[model samples]
Target chain A: MVIKVENLTKRYGDLIALDNFNLEVNHGEIFGLLGPNGSGKTTAINCILSLLKYDKGTVKIYNKPMAPDAYDIKEKIGLVMQNVAVFEELTVYENVDYFCGLYIKNKKLRLKLVEEAIDFVGISYYKDFYPKMLSGGLLRRLNIACGIAHQPKLIIFDEPTVAVDPQSRINILEGIQKLNKAGATIIYTSHYMEEVEQICTRIGIMDKGRIIAIGTKEELKDMISSGEKITVELFSMDNKILEDIKGLPHIVSAEYRDNSLIVRSSKGKNNLVSVLDYLKSNDIDFGRIYSEPPTLNDVFLEITGKELRD
Target chain B: MFLHNYIYRLKCIIRDKEFLFWTLLFPIILATLFNFAFSNITEAEKFTRLNIAVVDNEEFRQNTALQRAIKAAANSSGDKDQEGLFNIRYTSKEEGDKLLEDREIEGYIYLDNGIKLVVKESGLSQSIIKGFMDHFMQLSSTLETIIRKDPQSMERGILDKAEAAINYLKEVAPSKSSPDIVVNYFYNLIAMACMYGGFWGLKEVTVIQANLSSQGARINIAPIHKFKIFIVCVLAAVTVQLFEILLLLAYLALVLKISFGNQIGYIIFTCIVGTITGVTFGAFVASVVKKGEGVKIGILIGSSMTMSFLAGMMYDKMKYIISTKVPVIGYLNPANLITDCFYSLYYYGINTRFFINIGVLCVFIVFFSLCTYLILRRQKYASL
Candidate 1:
């Protein structure tokens, strides 16, 4: 295992942030920790990195227990916190070199790594510019460059694409995938479920200081009663017709709003044909219809009631 | 590996504007004020009064000899600015008691015979007048002897004596000479403003308060050892402070004539010590405040100025008072020891106390630096 956390429990006076949290990340796996805001995602990452003290738990990296004084393991681990971290005074290249130098002592090697980090983040043009002089997207890219310039085996990224433009977000996601391909174990955390669905191989949804569910995107989709979401745009919608439509078998939910009807179904077994037949038998008119499997958000809302579980 | 980080720390400090303002500029401005301008006397110039009556029943009261003497008797440096020194009351003995009881005056002087100065013995000004009167009496007795001995001049009247004194003054004129004043500094032999460096060295002090000093909190998590990090921070401070001292001393010596005699190297050495002292103090300040408190102005003011004062920066008498009341304060006062050591080299010669100043200054640097290390050591990164 690249990173293993067991029975991790952390308390701050009267508040318990992490309760018996456990996970084992294999090498080169993109492990995603998905949660709502304040669900102890950052807290868990902090404890595993020894940036916080845990009352009861064992955080091991490379089979060794992690502690604040574990410089050897810390040297090989890169943490890009939820908040962007880099020296404002230094240029992009200098910032990368400084952090990278902490691990790679060789001057020539550090210089090459720093250049690669800048190029990898698509911030090559801003290599000599200070962080303050850069735009938000460029600054975020620089933050990543500084963290990953060390090229550690285990790299943790906490909401790296936050406040970024679409282009920058795509670049960051691609860069993360490339890093994973290059044999780096990535521990990714984000509130954006779509992004997790796009990149994460295995997802872990946490709520109220506990892991509510953990699995692949498809596995998580199967766990919920809502199998798929079907949106149909009709010329007109009726109240009794929507109720009549909701009464159909395997039709988990139905709603009519803005001249459109939305139907939710569980265990997709030809519910679309059944729904079409029911609509035609009722002589209900519709223009167009579209269908998609349940997204990660639906799985998240199903497992952990979305009533502010944080 | 650490050197790269250390250099980065240096760059961070140099680029920090607020840190630069507090650590360097603040102290230099205060130092300039202390050195170039200061008020020595205050509160003592506020005044009370002196009441007295002059009388001579002797027939010579109208004599020119006594009249000339009376004018001369009132002659004093302060008396030259008329309406000052005394409020003369020409009254008889009968009014003396009434004036005293009515609180018209604190004392009464009945100048009968030679001169009898009477007082209520309740006020402080009485002693001042008494002292002045006693001194006047001795001079008058001497004058009488001179007059009696020169029987020929006595016939020519008191103006003749006055002329004679003026003639004597003209014959023996006070002369001016450029004395060789060699200066020897005790602590900072180089006359460096190293103490000024502490102001800038404490720039990282802002980091402790809030990460607002910078958007990123990378230094807190950087891989360098805490002590080594602190040392690097101080080195950056020293770089700035040393640059300042070099400029200051060079200007003071080449342009302003703050002579260091032949001990220029010694002055520089001591200045380096002062810089170390300043940087160490800066670290301590950084440890406590997380931002410079305008270069420890309250301490720099209280310590430096008082040191300058006790070391004759203000007045020599103040040195006596400080040495009497607080010896440690005097010894620890860098300016006091420095000026005294230099003054010894300038006016007298190098003494054992000079080395003592240098040694104590070194001790201050060591102690302050250790304090800075201990403080920086306590800062742990618990993701806090």
Candidate 2:
């Protein structure tokens, strides 16, 4: 494992920020800690990074205990904090170079890596601009550049796209995927399920300082009692046909409203095909149809009994 | 790693116009204002002549030696518009008394059986007039002794010695010039400027504490020893602050023409120690106080200003009063220590007092720095 956290517990006064939070990220994978705000995602990351004091448990990186003085382990880990943490006084190039110089002592190689990191984040054109002079998206990019300039083996991104524009968010997600492909194990955290679903190799859904579920997208979706949702556009739907669809195997619920017939399946391989065959057999005229397997949001909603963003 | 941190820290501080304004421009502006405000007072003390009246009485007419001495004292030295020792107005006793009472003349000479100096009140002019009278009395008494002991040897050199004693007394009177009070303002200003280094120190603290800033959080997770970063950043802060103070000193000495005596090495030592103490104190405050950045900054500024106020930055006499009233606080206050260091340098030669001030500052630097290190050495924070 690149990063392993076991039974981590942290408290702030009377409130427990992280309760027995456990996480493990393997090498060459983007492990996503998906949660809403205040779900202890950042707390867990902070504890693992040795930036916070935990009341219980231990954090290990590369099979060694993590500590403030774990320079050898820390050298292989890059952290992009939840907040923009670049020096406002430094230009983009200087900020990246300064942070990169922290790990890579060789001046020539640090310069090369700094340039590459800036280019990777697509912020080379704004290299001369200070953080304050850049737009929020560009600033976020610079923040990422500074963190990853040294090209550490394990990169932890804590909600790096929180306030970024949509385009920048896409670029950031792609950059993270690129980093993973380039052999850096990634630990990504965000409240946005779609981003995690798009890039994360395995997902851990957390709520109230505990991981509710952890698996690949397919495995997580299977864990829930909901599967592909089939929506068919219908000019008219009979109540008898809706009843018949509900009686079909694995059809959790079937409803007809506003010229559309919707069918939700609990678990089945061909729920959509069965619904379509039934529709045709009954000679129901449909305009359009859509079958979407359960989304990470759906899995999160089913497991948590609340909206992912709520 | 140390070089990188120091260079980046230097860049961050130098590019911050706000820091430059407080550390550099503000002191220079205050020094200029002090120069203008105290110009007249300092010049008057240094060069202005006193006004006096002499009574026209039998004692004065018969005292030929006294009359000749007064005439010589009244003659101008022919320097650019500078007046003599006294602007004398010979008048009757009633007129002279009226002049003294009306405050037109500082004092007057009352020639009677024996000469009596008359003044309504005591001040620099009154003191100078009294000094002259005392000098004349001593000379006349000595002459009387010489004449009584050996009347023939009196012409050998007694008169010449009396003249020399009279000239010597002339330099001791109003012309002697009191210590310049305006330099106290400049001294206090340098003290305030050095304490302003606390801002840089506070910035260093906030930047290294993960709970205080995102930059701090980012730094804490870096693969470097926390103490190394702390030392490097603090050195950078001191370097920037010391440079700013040196510039302020240059502005005072070169541009404003303020004198700080000739002890250049000691003055530099005092400034360096003061800067380090200010910054170290700031780091200590930042470490101990778990408040937000704004509150920490407010505390630093409030404490620095309060200390500067007590050090007599606004009213020079307050420093003396505090020293006499609450002497412990006077020594404890870094601003007071810095001001006193400059004060000792300006007034006295390099002596025990100056070294004592410098030693106290070094103690402060070490004590507060150790406290800061003790508080900050552990990198793990309760929260972030």
Candidate 3:
């Protein structure tokens, strides 16, 4: 395991930021912590990195205890914070070089690594520009380059794509994947479920400072009773038809509104086909149909009885 | 690693226009303005002969002793190179009154029961005339007592001894430099500049503490020890601040033609100590205050300016007043100590007082540095 956190507890005055938080990230696994705002994702990360003092628990990296002064363990960890963290007075190249120099003492090797990190982030064209001269996306890229220039064994990215444009978000996600492919264990945190779902091999759903669920995407989805959701557009639909759809096999709920029939089913195959067959036997003509597989949102809603974003 | 951190820190500080403006350019501008405002006042302070009209009447002619004393003062025979203290125009009593009224002379001296000095107003020149007359009266009274007690004492050269005593009190240069009171303003200006070095120190501290900034958070996770980074950044801040102080010093001494004395080595040493004190003081404030960067900066500026003001940055006499009335503040205030270091160097030329100021500054530096270390030694924050 690259990171092992057990029974971690932290409090700020009266509020518990983290309670019995336990986590284990394996080598070469991209672990994602998915939560809403103020869900203790940042607090857990800070505690794991030994940047924050916790009330109780232990954090270990590579099977050794982690601490503020654990340079050996810290040497293998890279952190890209939620906020952009680069010197405004320094150019992109110098910012990267300075941070890279902190870990890699060899000047020649440091120079090579800094350049490679800048290129990896695809900001080579703006390397000579100061941070203030760059746009938000470019600045975030520089922030990432500064964190990962030394190429540590484990890289932690905390909401790296917040407020970024769609194109830059795609680029950043792809870059993170590439970094993971190069054999680095990654810990990613975000409130955006889509982001966590798209790139995370395994996801941990966090709420109120505790991990509510943790598993692969498929496993997490299987843990919930809700499955695929099918929506059919119709010219008109009555309450009788909605009731009939609800009575169908594997159908958990059915509702008709705004000239569309929406049906949610339990975990089962051919749920969509069954809904269509019912509609056809009833001689109801549908204009359009959409069948979406159970998403992380559905899994969170089924488990928590609330929206993932809420 | 040290060199890399140090070099980058230096670059960041040097490129910071706000720090450079306050620590370097602002002092130069204020010094220039001080020079322009005080140039005439300094020139006017040069000693000029006081004009007086002595009543040439029966009492003055009969009192030959007073006559000879006044004549000696009017002539520059006491010191060959020095100018006479008084310019006497012998006239009748009525004419003397006219000269005083017309403001052609500072005052007029006439012997009634004794020598009496009359002036239009109280001023330096009028006060000098009064002082001279009073001294002569006291001397005459002393001589009369000596003769009455033992007339042979006069033949023993007591009169000549008294004359020699009077000459001993003549104005003399304390050192090989102009005792221009305006120079204190420049010293205070330099002290204020030194205090402004706290900005760089504050920046260094804010950048290193995880609770203060995102950059700080990023650095706390780095592989290197926190103290290593702090020391490196502080060294860089000191380097940049020292350079700025030297530049300001050069502008004041070489360009503004202000005399900070000829003790070049000691002056630079004081600058170094003062720069360290400023930076360390800033770091101490930043560490102790659990506030945002803006609030910390506000506190630093307010405290530094207050210290500078107490040290006579705004009012020249305030330093003297504080030192005399509130000696503890003079001893404790780094700005006051730094200013006094320069003042002592210029006037006393590396005396005990100069060393005392330097020593006090060293104490301040140690105290601030220790406090900052104590506060920052905690590697992990309770919150960020």
The root-mean-square deviation over C-alpha atoms between each candidate and the true structure, in angstroms, is 8.6, 4.9, 4.0
Cα deviation at B174, candidate 3, in Å, is 4.5
After superposing candidate 1, which stretches have Cα over 4 Å from the reference?
A: A307-310, B26-201, B204-224, B255-263, B288-383
Clashes of each: 16, 0, 0
TM-score of 1: 0.73
Considering every candidate listed, which one attains the maximal DockQ?
Answer: 3
Taking chain A by itself, what TM-score does each prediction score? Answer: 0.96, 0.93, 0.98
Q: Taking the true A–B contacts (Cα pairs closer than 8 Å), what share appears in each candidate?
A: 0.39, 0.86, 0.86
**A76-146, model 2: which lDDT tens digit per residue?**
98999879998889999999998888898899999999999999999989999988899999989999998
Q: State candidate 3's TM-score.
A: 0.88
Q: Each prediction's Cα lDDT score?
A: 0.68, 0.88, 0.90
Q: What is the interface RMSD of each candidate, in Å?
A: 3.7, 0.8, 0.7
DockQ for each candidate? 0.27, 0.70, 0.74
lDDT of 3 by residue, B199-301 (tens): 9999999899899989898888888887788899889999999999999999988899988889999999999999999999999999999888889889988
- The number of clashing residue pairs in model 3 is 0
Who wins the TM-score comparison? 3
Residue lDDT tens for model 1, B1-384: 557756877787678776566445554554455434422222345453455545434533655444454454444434434333455555666776788778776665554444576776644677777776675567567768877888666677764554334423333312221232122222232322454455565554444322323222344444445566566667766877776666666655675455555666665665676667767765565555533355454554354444444555335466567768988876877656655555444444455776787788778778877776675555433334
Candidate 2 or 3, higher TM-score?
A: 3
Q: Evaluate residue A162 in candidate 1 and report its C-alpha lDDT on the 0 to 100 scale.
A: 85
Worst 10 residues of 1 chain B by lDDT: B173-182
